[model samples]
Every structure is written in C-alpha cells, then in structure tokens.
Target: MERKQIRALGRRVKKIFIEHDEVKRIWSRFDGMRTYIKLDQFEDEDEEENDDDDKRNLFLTGLSGVGKSQIGKRYAKSVPRYTEIIDDEEIDIIPVIYVELPYPFTQAEFYKEILKALGTENFKKEPTVNELRNRVFHLLTKQRVEMIIFDEMNFIMRTKNFDNQSAMEMLKKLSNQLQLCIVCMGTPQIEKLHTMEDEYVRRFGRDRIERFEKCDEKFCELLERIEKAIESPNPIGLHDQSTGLPQLLHYYCQGRIGYLHLILKESFRLLNVYEENVQVEYSEIRLTVDIIKQAKFNLFRKNDHLITPDNVDKKEYMV
Candidate 1:
C-alpha cells in the first residue's frame, strides 16, 4: 500500500472508535455502578447489619464482536484517577482497574493477574497463593480502587482445573471483602456462571449487549451515523434504493459490529487500490460482501441462518 492508501485505511480504522448507542448505554451502567459503590463505601460501619452482603457486581455479557471489551475500556478511561483526603492523609485512588483474565485461569493465576494490573513488577515471584491473594487485596485497598473490571471472564469456564463453583466463590469473596464493585465482561458463555448457583445469580446483575437488528429504527440511525463518520472526497450513497444497507449488512455480517468493521475496512482498502478519489457506492459494498464471504467462509457457514432475508423472521428482526 502507498502512503495515501495507508492514510485512508488508517482514517477508516480510527472511525471504529465512534461512540454509538451501545457505548452510551455501557457508560450509563458504569456510572450507576460507581454510585452504588460510593453508597456502600460510606455506609455506617457501626451498624449491626451487614449491608455489604448485597452485591454491587455487574456481569456484562454479549456475543463475540458486540463491543463488550471496547465499552469496558472506554468506561475505564472515563474514570478520573486522583487522590482522596482520608484521616488527614492524601491517599491515591484509582477509580477503575481493568484486567483481562488469562485462559485456563486458576484462583492463584487470577490474583496474580490483578497484582500484575496493579503494576507489581515481581508479581509472579510470590511464593504462595496466600501471599498472592494478600498482595492483591492490599494493593486494591491501598490504592482505593472503586471498581474492578475483569474482561474475557468466560475463560473461567474453559479452565480444565477450575470448576464454575470455585470461580463464583472467588468472585463473591472478592466483592464482599474488598467492598468495591466488580464488572465482568465476556461472551454469552459467561452467562452459565450466573446460572451455576443461586448465590452467584443473586450477587451479579446481568447486562446484555446486542447487535443491530435489520428492521429497527436505531439500525437505520446507526447506518446514517456511520455514513457521516466516513470521510470521502466523492459523495457515496451507502444504501441502495432496492435493498437498504442495513438489510445487506445484516445478511452478510449477521448483525455483528466486528464483522461489519472488517467489511468496511476491506471496502476502503479496495477503494484505495482502484479509485483515485475514494467514494463508497452500493456496488462496491456488494463486491466487498463477496470478498468478505470468501475470506470469512467459516463464519458464514456457522451463521447460515442469517444468510438470506427469508431466514430472518419478523419476531427476531423487528423493532
């Protein structure tokens, strides 16, 4: 790719960071979670009752490519890191700490991950699980972290040595002991963690991130926003008069924002290669769909139910 082509591709890729309705919703939820954390933190310490039993934990689940991780990162960045006055001393408070769970994780590995996220240089050098856990708790409390977000939480289920019950216990213990909010983001498979036990289900509230439905008004609005975000020298009619762009995209990408991103990135790359002044047309989009179909053969094969308009039912796609 030449300099201009590379620049054009870079511009298109940068547009992926645009905050849509989904991103806004995630932010709203994060704000609410922070409010709850504040309330719990300031509760009467002398009260005989244990109000901390009420879980302020959030479980954010969605299918792959629905922007779960992206929204989590955005929320993390929005939190202001500052110092708080406590007992005549200034203590550093990290409003949010985001960590991604490693695959085949164990309880020890999980705490090690938290220690690593806290910027501990020799975290792996901890001799025992007790030491690791103590270090994690000490760092989180000392730093005064309001919320801890665990991304790719579904890895708990895939771990060969760890069972779902043990993972749930660990999470529950952390939230109860730390007195801070915990947000877990992962694929829909993580929903099984909630279903494994009633205590788990009661403690963690669920938040779902869904893809764009074909016939929904928001889908059309999203398309318009996406069109405006794309910068082109020549005017581009993204949608065809016969079949709307939303419908076409739904059929090709199965309403996945990640797949749509791939299609658009490839489309822009194609325009950079052939057209002098980059402008996207309905024909170019159609060609891009064919190219994506060939490139993502396995994806198309798996989601064959979304391949045609006839297969898409009114109940599922309707607003």
Candidate 2:
C-alpha cells in the first residue's frame, strides 16, 4: 500500500474505535475499586475510629508505572462521596489533602509544604516549624480532612542520610496523635524505608498490612476492557475466525494495562488513513506486540536496577 493510504487507514481506525472519554471513565471506575476505594476505605475507617473527629492516614506502596499516582488522584477526587455518609457535625465534607512529596525530607521542610497545601501562607508571627506543624494538625483536625495522600514518597528517601527515616517517624507520630489515617503512596522502593532497620520495620508494621499488588487475573481483565473500549471491527483483511478476541487482546497487552492502551493508541494512529475496516489478525499484531515488548523491556532495563538515590531523580521516580 502507498504511504498516504496507510496513514488514511490509521486515521479511520482511530475515529471508529476511539472513545477517549468512555475509556477514561471505565478505567477510572475500575481503578477506583481495585486501587483507590480499598485504600480510601481504610483511611475512612481510621477516621471513624476517632469518633469521626480526626482524619485518617494510609500508606500505599507499589511498582513504578503501576498506577499508584493515578489511583491516588482518583481517591482524592472521590473524597466528596464520603461527605454524604458523614454527619454535618462530624465533618461538612471530607477534605482530601494530597501532597506530592517530591521534596521536603526534613520535618521542617515537610511541615512547610503541609502548611502550603493547607493554604496557610506567610505567618507574619515568624512561627517556627513546630508551630507550623501544630497549625497544620489543628487545621486538619478542625476542618475534618478525612484523608491525606502523600504521592511520590520515594522522593523523601532521596534526601540522603536519615532524613527520610526521621520524617517518617514524625508522620507516624502525627498519625497517632491526631488519630488520622495517612495514606503514603509511592514506588516499591518505599518498602526499603520500612525494611532498613528492625525498629523501622516494627514501626511501619508488616508488609501484608500495608502494600498490595493487583492480581494477574484482575490486571488482564482490566486490559481486556480497555481493548474492547478502543477497538473497532475490522473489515478488509483476514479475520481469523479460529481465534478468540479476548485472547488476542490479552496476548497483545501482555498483562500490563498501561501498555495495552499505549499499543492500541499507537496502532490506531497508524490505521487512521483509511476508513475501511481492515481485518487485524494475530500476524498483523505480532509487530505491534514486538514494538510494545521492546519498549517495555527497555524501560524496565533502564530502571529495574536497584533504585539508588541517583536513579530516583529519573522520570519514573518523580511525581
């Protein structure tokens, strides 16, 4: 086929299959359940434990590009839903405080960011860090901020020395003092923070108590749904009647929900040129699969090594 014809096909396929909004909605709802709701509920219950007078804290650890930050944002968005269940006296609306911990390794710096997030800027009284910390606590306590989400908490560890450790201790102390469930979201390296010392491990509790990874079945199902949402019926080429649709999609995605979308999106871009339905067989998809797998491998190879302080500055580690 001519280059112009191929481009035309790519454009047409994109138009036929692309429901960007619907795809996002589907992914969001599923992500909310599989990732956010589970964690948010933990925090919600922790808040309730304090006679509904205090917020809750939770810590979420996962692999990079494994949907931690995405789910964190969704959890924050869903904070309003908890308001309906909350009594007016207990909390007017569940205030979700989401702070990306890309900086601020010390208690002072951390508190400064907390204050900034709370919209308390420039205390003319020249308050010390302790004072600002107390102010944030009081504000959250009074405001009924039901949830606090710390995304990219791995950044805290990059500050070097024991700063990250000390900061985490302060966080744990605040969680106990305020009876708030604080959700810490970050890459798998975050487990290192807890595993470093016997005391540290004890303070953070057991691994099963905090970190949760998605099951393979759930991941594949998520990818299949995304494929259905973004795929159009093919018309011209050989449509292998012998094979299964879901099976084909699952194979293409290789169990990574994120890569599934990326491949489908790129494939559509390549097929937009012609509006005619072209049958996409397993053979046609082999090239796409190879491309996606190579990309994935290259990405993992670059960062799969131990997350050193230096490597943490790369794109994957940043918020």
Candidate 3:
C-alpha cells in the first residue's frame, strides 16, 4: 500500500471518536464545578483566603483508556478561550489549565510542571520552592484560570520519595490560596487520597469511569456508534448476523475502550492493505484481533490483562 493510502485510512479510523453517556455525565460534573467556582467568586471578594468554603474539586478515577483524559480535554475545550478585564487592566483568562503530573514529583517539581504547561520559557531554571510557588500563584491569577486539571495523578502515589501528607497539605493550601476549581484524573489508585485526610476528602468529589461490560445494552450501542463511524463500502455491523463481533470484541478487549479502538484501527488498516477499499467486514475484524492481541502482548508482556480471564467480571458476562 502507498503511504498516502495508509495515512488516509488512519485519518478515517481516528474520526471514530465517540462520545457516550459517560462522557456527558463527566462533562456535566465539570459544568457544576464551574458554576460553584463562579458563585464563590461572586459572593466573596476574599474567596481566595476563605478556607471555610469547601473547594469544589473533582477527582476522575478509572483504569487506563477509559476516556478520562478525553472527557477532560473536551470539557476544557468547551470553556471560552478569552480574556477578562480587572481594574482597567486586561487579564488573559485561561478558562482551563490542563497539566499532566510527572511521576515522583515534589511540591516544587509539581509547580515547575505547571509552569512548563503554561509555556514558561525558563521552567527548568533552578528557582527556590517559594519562588516557584509565588510564580504559579501569580500566573494562575493573572491568567484568570478558572480550573486547573491534573491528569495522571496516580503518579503522585507511584513516586519513590512521595509524602502523601505533605502533598495533601500543599494541595489544600493551593486550593484555598488560588480559589480555582481543581480536577484530578488518574487510575483507581487515586481513591487512596480520599482516605488519607478528612480535609482532602471534603475538598473533592469523586467519579469513576466504568468499563463497557459484555452483554450490556451500552456495549451494543457503542458498537453501533463504531459501525456508523467507519466509512466502509460494505455496511459494517458488529452487532448483526454477518459479524456478531460485539461479543467477541468485548471478550477480547476485556471491555477496554482503548483496546476496542486499537482493534478497529487495525481492522481498517488491514482493509486498506489488501482490499484497496474502505470495506470493513467480519473477515477484517477477525484478522485484526490477532494483530491487536500480539501488539498488546508485545507492549505489556505478562501484564496484558486483556487476555486474562480474571480481569473480566464473571457476573457481567456469565450468561
């Protein structure tokens, strides 16, 4: 196949992005958070110093590839990208500031990461912890950031020199000082934060992204969405008699959206390779399964949980 043909197929596959009920629910929660922040800002001029008003922070927990980051990015993009005026001066209001937490980050390192995410030129420069903290506070306020989202928050737990107590303290302090809504996205490990401290628990609301289980109506609906997205000459029906691929895919992917996406992308790639047409069929899906399995095995090795029966919930697929 020509490189251009392959690239075109890739583009078609990428267009298969689907937003389901879960995404809407997450986005709604973010909307509520924004409302709370706006109310806090309006009612109190000294809201930044008032620790009495509980922080309307959000914690998004899920396994990898359950679309937490996707939902976060979508919600962030929905916020108007513009500036605000304060005291006759123009202030750039970044409605959302999204930062991915680096593994094993200290309070200082975390601030530096935020600076880098904010496009600071000398983010790597050796600044004192206080200096960094001050800079972050100034930038966030000056930029008029309404919310700060930290994705991959589980890295805080995975860090070798991590101190949960001090970290929690810093986060609480920052929330009170900035008075900006904070959103944390990570795997199930972040649930540990809720148990670490009462203040921390009180500050954030938690939501989990569940996997698409086998035999569920949502699973079939997701397949239908996928079928519609694929621009194939032949109708691609994963739920229909020609394929009945939804069940097989649910089993093979262990209900992971990421895995399903990989399978579909590979299926499209295979179609491009041999058929020279965008025709997704049962044979293409079946052929792509092995490719997905092998890729998963090569990347994750023994930890390829998709192939492990234990990863699947028996109650959900027992029938």
Local accuracy of candidate 2 as per-residue lDDT tens digits, 1-319? 4444455445443433222333354334433433432454567454554323222333456544335555566656655534333354543344666677646366666777766666666877777877878888887776666556777788787777546667778777766676555667776778777676565444343211111122234444454344454333432211222333334433433333344445455645443323346543422433243444454344444444323332222332121
lDDT score for candidate 2 against the true structure: 0.50
Q: For every candidate structure, what is the RMSD over all alpha carbons to the true structure, in angstroms? A: 5.2, 10.8, 4.6
Candidate 3: stretches off by over 4 Å? 1-6, 44-55, 83-91, 123-125, 269-304, 307-319
Give candidate 3's error at residue 134 in angstroms.
Answer: 1.4
Residues 164-217 of candidate 1 have per-residue lDDT tens digits of 788888878888888888898898788888888787777888889887656456
Give lDDT: candidate 2, residue 56.
35
Per residue, candidate 3 scores C-alpha lDDT tens digits across 38-132 of 88756756544444455478778988777777777767777887767889987767778778887777888799888876667384568898999
Could you tell me every candidate's TM-score relative to the true structure? 0.78, 0.53, 0.80
Location of the lowest summed lDDT over 10 successive residues in candidate 2: 206-215
Better of 1 and 2 by TM-score: 1
Measured by TM-score, how close is model 2 to the native structure?
0.53
* RMSD, candidate 2, Å: 10.8
Quantify all predictions' global Cα lDDT against the true fold.
Answer: 0.71, 0.50, 0.71
